[model samples]
Target: MKYPLFITQHGELKRESNSLVFSGELIKKAIPLAQISEIHCLARVSLTSGAIDILSEKSIPVHFYTTKGDYKGSFINDASPRGKLHLKQAEHYLNPEKRAYIAQQMVQGIQNNMAFTLSRWGINPVKLNSISVEGSSMEELMGIEAQLWNLYYAYFGEVLGVKDFKRTRRPPEDEINALISYGNGVVYGLALSSVLKAGLDPSIGFLHEPSEKRYSLALDIADVFKPLYVFSTIKALIKNKVMKRSDFSRNKNSVYLSREGKRKFLEALTDTLRRTVYYKPWRRSMSYRFMMDYEARRLVRHLKGKSKYKAFKPWWR
Candidate 1:
């Protein structure tokens, strides 16, 4: 099965015939192009032109992240372009009522997933029920979403036994914040891959307004799944006492995961995505990764008026 390839060491990626090889100081590995769903470079990895050509030919996306785990950008090959679907997607964005509906649904999904996850963690998030999704304007809707997340963060910190936890970004102020920032970036990259596979413009989003060099639609979709995948992984790691203090490093006031830390986290995250769960629409089990792609396709169907779009709400295991 194809899986995401993560490069955590500084290396050079070269195309060796039909396979891609990573050459670093202490490690050398070759991966068949057929076995990779996506590539994420979390370190300073240089790609050869030949490698780029093959990846483009295969329509494989390569996501780049800074040393601090901030999403820099992505190299995506637009192999399939559905012009008609693009028009329908833009039409939905152009219509205020349609845009509002989609945005509300996305927020509702985020809320539901957040509450469900919290409950599973033995934290009853009754406060999320008080927040209303029937906001008339985009600002009001966004405000409600922000409020929900704030409450979530508070509960998340409490359950994790992290005192006075606050969400900080860029240069994360604490270890948990660093993990959240990095995990969210990974989720966003996965969502962007799904949007590209669905042939949708990632920049055009319903909840998040389109901005330069930003895949806002992926951000909107990623929000729904963050609680399910990202936070869940973190919780498991903490509960199992798998992550050590040495896994993190501090530079002045900022804290970030060390190289070993990323490897451990990514391993856990991959397992989370790979686990199969029952999907009601399909009436069968599906991986979390597949569910993300399916969610994007469902949005496309909604844009084409073939069906009403519903955000994914997994059956908690």
Candidate 2:
């Protein structure tokens, strides 16, 4: 299958018949429609109205990114007629009990994966009620998820070998947080594309609150993958000294990957996505890139009542 493409330079995207053309000061590329699943504009990338129209017609998702690698928003095609799947999703949403169940599962999946990552380093998370989602209300569930993240970040210093690596956003205060912001953008972009590919509504979510422009479902789904896809990759890059303090720059109250650093991080992330994993049940190997789409299909199966939904959490068995 075609893959998601990342555009990291100042460029203009235009429609060229059946292909998409990206024109940059240093290079130009025209990718055929058949060879692309989605496009993420990482920096100063503008698009023509024709490009937007054609992209929508083709049902390809496009996401915009800020310079620091935060997800700005996405332009998704107006979904074509949903046969029955969306109706089922709405039913789940309107029912408080069902929605809470899915939300709890999502939090459980993320916490379990976080614990797995910690286990890989032979480090145990300081015991906290961080993994349980058996909350009495939606507010309580959200509070539990938030608390787990604090507990999760507590180990960043030990695991990533970066000192004082607290989670920071808006303007990331340090190098690792900056990398994470960028890495999270990557995760969200890929998640959004895969959700679109599976014909799922990105706005209607389980764990995260649905809002005006945010793809909450993508955020919710991405939680399960970020530890493996983003954090592990970050750990590798830092431990290998491939990324250093020199790769980052400080702005007013924020740190961001320099253009060169952004290039380095994206290259590493692309390599991570292409890395193969052995899917035991199928007894075949698939790239990490495929997992996003796989999860989308799994969610569909659960929604259709063919099976119970189980979020994939990478762990050593």
Candidate 3:
């Protein structure tokens, strides 16, 4: 089984003894039960009481939205944190030196991910031209980091067949922006899930500020994997022509995804993660979903000090 989404249209979901069946005038097909992690209702849809109970039992989250794709909210069956571990996490955050240590770890994670990315493309890991490395200082590390991400976006353009694509600034102004935002959203969700599984306080993060609404820790961790998850999908979409310029709409200063565009983007993202990726750190490569779960375990290990904290390096070289 794989990750699945159960989208509801004009019908209600009902649970049978062994299966979930949809009933209504516009009951769409049910996705495979084992593969489903989420059920997104794009329309005003109903669910039988029995179906709700079953969904809760399965630990699947249901997200509701209007017909026009306005996000209403999500129904999560399990949202608890590990109370004991969360206390320790809070204590760590309150101490200045401890926070700085964690911050150093966070930076290391980012650097390691950059190293991994450069290694993937067979690019030189260190900036030889910039400085003679006595084994790589912070400045040389930053230089290499900049170069790796530039190459990452270059790969994005090549993958998507967008000859004129540029790496976007914040708030996203074009089709590329829409894909980037959607991909980052997926990354955040996956990271949040990982944080929850690790028993960490998602609001308290090493690399990101705690003042924001988002789980800062999740955002920090998401940065490590966002390029791989989102950029790669954009490339695939372009290669298959699953999406086109017509799928986007421009207002004064920003571009937004049309309904069809959102559907296609989500489909591409799901498919991309399900595709197997070879990760050298893990002797046997796994799917993106498994990679996400592995990151959660990594965070746990970092807190417990069983393994050193390292960020994801891009698979570019």
Candidate 2 Cα deviation (angstroms), residue 178 = 1.2
Q: How accurate is candidate 2 locally (lDDT)?
A: 0.80
Best candidate, TM-score: 1
Instruction: Write down the lDDT that model 1 would get.
Output: 0.86
Which candidate, 1 or 3, has the higher lDDT?
A: 1
lDDT of each: 0.86, 0.80, 0.64
Per-candidate alpha-carbon RMSD to the true structure: 2.0, 3.0, 5.0
Model 1: per-residue Cα lDDT over 1-317, one tens digit each: 46778788899988887787899768989967786888888889888998898888888889898876768888878888789888888999999999998998899889988988898888878888778786557889889889999999999999999887899987888878878888998889888888888999888999999998678999998998999889989998888888888999999888899888988888888888887877676788888777788889989989988999875676756
Candidate 1 lDDT trough over 10 residues, lowest sum: 308-317
Per-residue lDDT for 1-317 in model 2, tens only?
56677888898999887667889879988867786778888878888997888788878888898876778877888557565878787788889988887887788777877887777777877564335565547888888888878777878677766565579988788788888988988898888878778877888898888988778899988888887788878877877789867789998789988998998888888787887767778888877788788888888788888888875776333
Order of candidate numbers by TM-score, starting with the best: 1, 2, 3
RMSD of 3: 5.0
Better of 2 and 3 by lDDT: 2
How much is the lDDT of residue 266 in candidate 2?
Answer: 83
**Candidate 2 Cα misplacement greater than 4 A, ranges:** 14-21, 30-35, 46-58, 73-75, 126-130, 133-139, 315-317
TM-score of 3: 0.73
